[model samples]
Target: MNIAQLSGRGVEITDPLREYVDEKLSRLDRFHDQITSARVTLTVRDVKNAARRNRVEVQINVPNGIIRAEESNADMYAAIDKASDVLERQLRKFKTKFLKQRHEAQPQPEPGPAEQAAQLGEEDGEVQPEIVRQKRFELRPMTPQDAVFQMEALGHDFYVFKNMGTDSCGVVYRRKDGHYGLIEPK
Candidate 1:
């Protein structure tokens, strides 16, 4: 498990406060033992729209996806409690979804020969020819950041290239929020 914290410029966290956070977050182990890693990031934000509100955002990223929990309260402890509960609920949801999908994993039947032949032909009784075109591109090894930039320059949302760091082919893409995301082979 990994934990990182970055509070806002004006926010201050004492050593005791940090310890308290660790204690509460450590309880996540009780819910998921197979959780390979838990990344906890704490951030503080000031709402220009609402000055009186307290804003604390906690983001947890595990193997499947990211679970974000944000809360605002007059008291910091209350905010933390609410955020923890949000995370717990999100994890529970993920657990339930995974089990449900696993139970529904069944193989589909292949198309019959008659249907396949009709699909390969056209309505006018014309047989489509195979081997339309062939093309190839050179792959360059680079870091994830460089690959993402290349993808943007090429007007593509995603790009595949060799990862110089891990010696594996990886995919880099731009997220909807204008942020970068990456996928690496296990």
Candidate 2:
């Protein structure tokens, strides 16, 4: 377990509030033991609207990925509780997903050249300066429409696929304007 960093936008982080948040988030370690660190941010937004002014956001760093949860409520304590609940739910879901991925059957892409290079680098203990993380999966062929559906279904901001019609690599991404954009190799 780690102490959460307490920060406030318009409100002061009193000792009691800090202790409360730390106590609440410490329970998360029970859900996911691999959590390395956690950062919490508390904000008082819209001072006039006390009904939904208190906002709490928590970010946890784990070995595989980072988990984040945010909640807003009338009271700071309530917000903290809600955020912790959300994080617990997310952590549980992540655990379920990895366990399922291990036993369940799913389509997977073959290793590409990049994966080969990464494997070689690991074998040789040579550091690759540019690449921080590398993920290898089968590039399934799909249409732009299908890519958009897949991206939304996965709850990701972007998705990459092999364009079936164009026979090129393409990316479909959610845009800031609540729209989808497609990028294809020219």
Report the lDDT tens digits of candidate 2 across residue range 24-116: 988888888888888888998775644548899887866545577878888889889998888888788776665665586653432222212
- Compare the candidates by TM-score and give the number of the best one: 2
lDDT of 1 by residue, 22-46 (tens): 6776777666554654444344556
Residue 172 lDDT, candidate 2, scale 0-100: 73
TM-score of candidate 2 on Cα atoms, chains taken together: 0.58
- Each model's lDDT: 0.59, 0.72
Off by over 4 Å in 1: 6-8, 34-52, 106-186
Off by over 4 Å in 2: 47-52, 103-107, 110-156, 159-186
Question: Cα RMSD for candidate 1?
Answer: 15.1
